[model samples]
Target chain A: MGAMDNTPIGGDTRVAALWDGLSRVMDPELDESIVDLGFVTDVSLDAAGRVDVGFRLPTYWCSPNFAFLMVDDIARELARLPFVREVHPKLHDHMASDEVNRGAHLGLSFAETFSAFEVSGTLEDLRETFHRKAFQRRQEAVILGLRRAGWSNAAIVSADLATLDRVVLEDEEAARQKPRYRELLLARALASTPSDRAFVTLEGAPLTEVTLPAHMRALRAVRINMEANGALCRGLLDARYGEAPAPEVPAHEPDHAAHACGGGGKACCGGCARQVSAFQPTAAPDL
Target chain B: MYTTPDGEEVFIIDGHTHFWDGSPENQKNIHGKQFIDCFYGYHSSLSPKDKLWTREQFAKYSADKMYHDLFVDGPDDMAIVQSTYLKDFYKNGFNTIERNHEMAQGQPGRFIVNGAYDPRDGEEALEYIHFLKETYDVKGVKLYTAEWKGESRGWKLTDPNSYRCLELCQKLGITNVHIHKGPTIIPLDKDAFDVHDVDHVATDFQGLNFIIEHCGLPRLDDFCWIAVQETNVYGGLAVALPFIHSRPRYFAEVISELLFWVGEDKLLFGSDYAIWTPRWLVEKFWNFEIPEDIKQEHGVDLTKEAKRKILGLNAARLYNIDVEAQKVRLKNSPLAVAAE
Candidate 1:
């Protein structure tokens, strides 16, 4: 399903737009959209374009730093919309719900929200840490898909963003994964320079043939940790909500051959391409 | 204890087990309710069908039920009663040392009553550790680094006061330091259960064996990396073992990784009982063979001896339980005679 298309909030374009905006806000730990993770429980907007979004994590005690980041990101994303007069984010069933909601409404910084505790650094530090992890995870998925498609480690490490994009577009298996990987790669790369090689380390060091194997191995651990966490969160969320949990976007397209029968050119892979395109918000709001 | 068809005896020691009371009467607030409910989620999701318990029973099962689950009906030769003193959540404290000690008193030698301490209490906690040692002779301690104390959500093992507590543990001869590094500690602003803190103390106090419970899960890779470096560090397979039933492939990956990184000698089996029973976990683990792919990838074999060590012997060595001697006693004991 398209990211924007699976809005549980029906018939209201305002709420739909709000949902679409919130969909961009991901649980940094899981690297999945809050909406798709069943975290965005309710979204509404008044006639005045004042948006109030309610969301919950898989558990009451999900990392407060992560919870704050999501709530803060949701408010910021919604406020970016020209129509949104004011944004109020409500976090329900969380340990720090009151603090989070109050802080978000008041536009309090994460440091200001929980001043009692000793926060080592700013929320950005935490975000960047997860961002680097998410980048590695997404990058690993693409690499795994490319490897399965018979690309050598040398070919993968040597390929630039443009080359990688072409490779993804040309291969049916890679094409199915392109949009999400491309979006994450762009997001991470754009921070330095869009022209910079996409498959660099968090420190912006480009991978060499020698480094690529070790890099992939290290990233595989990160991917497994994140994927296992995502699975546990989904299970916990399912138990908490007891509703049919939202179908997860497969972490990896393990069955590359099954999707390979679809023609390789971008045009023939319309179905998967459309799903990818849905994630690219027109506003291009900063995460 | 279980005997395989090959007539090899496998002594089972549930290295991590709890007797918690999350019943509404004991629950101080919604967090208490949420805490046990979260456990129930894991229980229902991972436990085999026949082994699963109702939410109500799981909330607060009886002492009799715990005994039946771990000793009478289950495969545990001896179980470590890991005390989790969540005073902030439960009225008297959820799964306090006192409750575990009381439960274990009925069946002596079947349990090792591990106590807990909050280093945040500082000197008072040091004294309390002495008190716990003198009263229960607690050979080990279950440290909840993420436990909330008043305004503070959690404290780290590397904290100044924590060092003092570790010193006391060394002084008091509490060698087995089982640190709880699983999900959801209060004051989530920090990574409360970060295994990094354990690394600090593990280095500082070489005399104390730090058994990281749940194997520092969700951060298993991190735990594995640390475990390899620290000879004194061990992995307690409480939450990790239950995955053997529900997610065997993932379970293989976890076990394979542990085998590769932590090695069989340092890994300990734990049921986290009441949430999960020892019966199925022990049985499934005995039957579980590392898939050829995983075995090949990690280049580690999950031999029967390895399973034997993980199930009990590793923990036995840590706690100084003589498995051979205990097995001999069990062989002649009335329980074995009655079973025969």
Candidate 2:
């Protein structure tokens, strides 16, 4: 119907089969299942059991790092489902630095790194082709920028693409980080989302909690810590946006370890704004 | 060939246009408008020979003389703009305009002039824009290649090169990006000049306004689509229409298409005139088939009234011109002493 229609309604046999598998994948940052978080916006089940699943992140042009990771996680998780044959985690719109909007597209169309299928010879060629294809895109970005600036190809051909490449990345980062303000903002956010005692304990819960007779008392104390931090974060925007204390036995507290981002990296518990600029803008404004 | 219906002298307001007349030969001995501290200058590809449309020449030139005025009917009001590119090409910027202003303002609702600012000129652009707004009663701005494409993209807007230009524009509340775009009258695929290039800086300065030049044909798809996608961005339409009708046509298309898609009211008409689309060429565009939804949204007829709005009312509004109530100001106020 519409571009955004994505509900699993009536007679969807394939989605019905793999629904449980899809629901299990979590958005590493938010420990809850992605489906529960409404991340799985659309699900399609084919006659051959080919499943295509699409979802959106909170923001358009979200980080490619986690986006790719999220896509891969779904494919891997669904591969284990009993009747599932082929699974494709389609992340409709994502942010990638190189091309216009083709990071995952390149990843899937070329690398096939997100798939559970044995890599095909065609996939291998496509991956190599992506790297080659990138050369043309690079040329396009550089040439287009120069031509607009009044430079002819003959004039800029001798110019190094490396310089253009650097300019592109540098220029982009400068825009995103609000070079004039992010550090100040980061400092402000850090001061706000400081974690609580319970969140840390809950994160460190024993593996046995899934089915064992482990330290339920110590774990529940952690839950109390979580409630307090939850109140603080809910009470204040800072807790959600600010620097969450560390995840470890932080004489400090880590925000929510469940979904603060990065895989198993203790640093992730730091919070979203804590992300070091993937491409830190180095241009200092001329004050 | 077309008369303003029964010689009623048509309702036309060139909401956006530019001027660059050198200090007059007749006023040679007397002190001239060029001596003012806020003198203006711009980098333009058009040579001096092309820019010498005298105030007298401009005042008398029938907008219909140019072979391009057949598209749209004229508006009841007229607004003018400065050429961010052509200032230095002819004479000093403010000096050129002072004379043109003297000649152009004689017609009651026929003209509204904007100022010019080159971001590379830095604080000077801001300083002058401020002065033009308060002192000269300049209604908007004329941003050329160096202003938007230059500071925002090339030098990187993050550098304060263009940010301050836009910051000051936004702070003063101006939204005219008399911006130039397209296959650089040169050659190269530099993404810096691409139509989407502005998205980088534009995202940062959300409130500051724009009127993308050449109707953003360099990347018409993105430029037009962005109008729908990005509500803050408005595209400017004008220029030698006999040769560049595609520009206004595309401008209307982008405005109409975006109306349906992104569904926002953010299109403004700019006749990068005098050098480009003197009234004649623009008149041809007055009749370009505007979409019904757009006409309804703007609350004007499907044709003439919509064209009038496009030619003047739209920019007048974006540039903060109150079409109706503005007529009541004191006779001594700077703008009142001149014209609406």
Candidate 3:
């Protein structure tokens, strides 16, 4: 769905673009794309360029702040498409769905929607917190990948962006996160230019040989927490919607496995790619 | 009791459980239904296929079923049934102390029912704590800080009113505070599941034990940091234990960190009944081992002794249960004999 098509305004192509746009919006807490998490159930478009996106969380009691942030990001991301006129993101079956949808429609912020309770800080604060966590989680994956690929601590600590880009990571998890890590690294301005150190603390401090172990320890915690939460969310979402992935088939029966779900290429988790196949939403009709 | 492959008996105290009426007839609003649905999601998602329950059975089960799930068919020596009075969501409240105490009355010495009170209720909260102590004689209270009350969505352990309630609890000899610091949830903007409040309250209420359920997951790092410094802080494995079945690798990673930081003596096992049964969770956890890589990385081991401690000894310590004597008592209990 993400592959760019040359056919402008074609019904199928536009709907694909709509999904691609939604794919870029992440669940801030889990730091995974909403589309991949199966939180996004449907996306429909009309001839007038108005887009309606429907999404649901693993539970009715998912954090309203996160629900709001995702809904807001959906509106913002979909509106970026040149063909899109208005974006209406609907959060279904949540405790604060009405407030979130109404707030999104009126262009209100999270604080505006639920102002009764005290807000610890701006939504930006929450975003920044998750951003730092995402950066750390991605960084940990890349570093662990490098170590597994036979890189020494000294070499890893001193490695620069150019060196990182040139090196090959054999580990699947690391390889997948390499681009994501680099993107955040560049986007957050943590590192820039070819010579910039590939690894740096959230505050821009470069890791030294003596400090790498402690840094890795901190990153490991962050990674573990995020991964655990991600698994829980996926499980709950499956249970709520009765959308559990197909039962595990014998590894020898590759043909049957592929046919049961779909081609194995779409799975985010390596080897068990079919595990996430049920989560992938089919294309919606463009009316 | 879980008898090991070598014939060693391992006592298990399910540190967290719930006996509630989440049935359609009990649901006061959509929140009640959704709350139970969310629990069902957790159940179906993580439980072994054989352990899964139908939605109707999960919504409300017979007391005999809970007893069978925790003891007769399960390995738990004693279960701590926690009360969560979601009065706003349910018609008669989710699981009040009255209901739990009543449930425990039928099976003596097999249940340690915990009471709950809202600190946001101010003076009434203190009064309720006293009432809980006198009426129920509760040695522990499960704090659902995210519970909704009228206009307010949630409260914190460090709130001024909460301090007053804790002071009352401490004075009344309620030594255990099982705070629900699991996944992050509602009350927009503020982190309803934040564990930082545990830091402050744990420090102040030194006499009380703060057992953060789900090991403050999704915030394990923060919880670990706080737990490492505070001797009184603990991590309950209710929500985390089910991971042993579905995501063993992830569970190993989390347990490795907890063993390293929180230590084996401070970690407790809980099945979070109705959501997931104890039988499968206990069996899987008993046989589970942290991978060599995770063990070495954390410089820790999930040895036989550690398993024994986490499963029962740790919680037994918190509740002041004389393990040897309790074991003897349970050995002679009517239910134990009946099961045999």
Scoring only the A-chain of each prediction against the true A-chain gives TM-scores of 0.75, 0.35, 0.83
Please provide, for model 1 over B224-255, each residue's C-alpha lDDT reduced to its tens digit, 9 standing for 90 to 100: 88999999999988877776654455567678
Q: For every model in order, what is the number of clashing pairs?
A: 0, 53, 0
- Which residues of candidate 3, in runs, are more than 4 Å off? A1-9, A116-121, A246-280, A284-287, B336-340
Best by lDDT: 3
Candidate 3 reaches a DockQ of 0.43
CAPRI class of candidate 1: acceptable
Which residue pairs in candidate 1 have backbone atoms (N, alpha carbon, C) closer than 3 angstroms, thus clashing? Answer: none
Ranking by DockQ: 3, 1, 2
TM-score of the second chain for every model: 0.96, 0.60, 0.97
Tens digits of per-residue lDDT, candidate 3, B223-289, equal 9999999999999998888877666666777899999889999999998997888888877888887
DockQ of each: 0.27, 0.01, 0.43
lDDT of each: 0.75, 0.41, 0.83
Q: Give the residue spans of candidate 1 off by over 4 A.
A: A1-14, A116-121, A169-198, A245-287, B5-7, B335-340
TM of chain B vs. native, candidate 2: 0.60
Q: For residues A80-172, could you state the per-residue lDDT of candidate 1 as single tens digits?
A: 887788888888888889888988888888888887766565767667767777777777777777887888878777677667655644444
Point out the higher-scoring one by lDDT: 2 or 3: 3
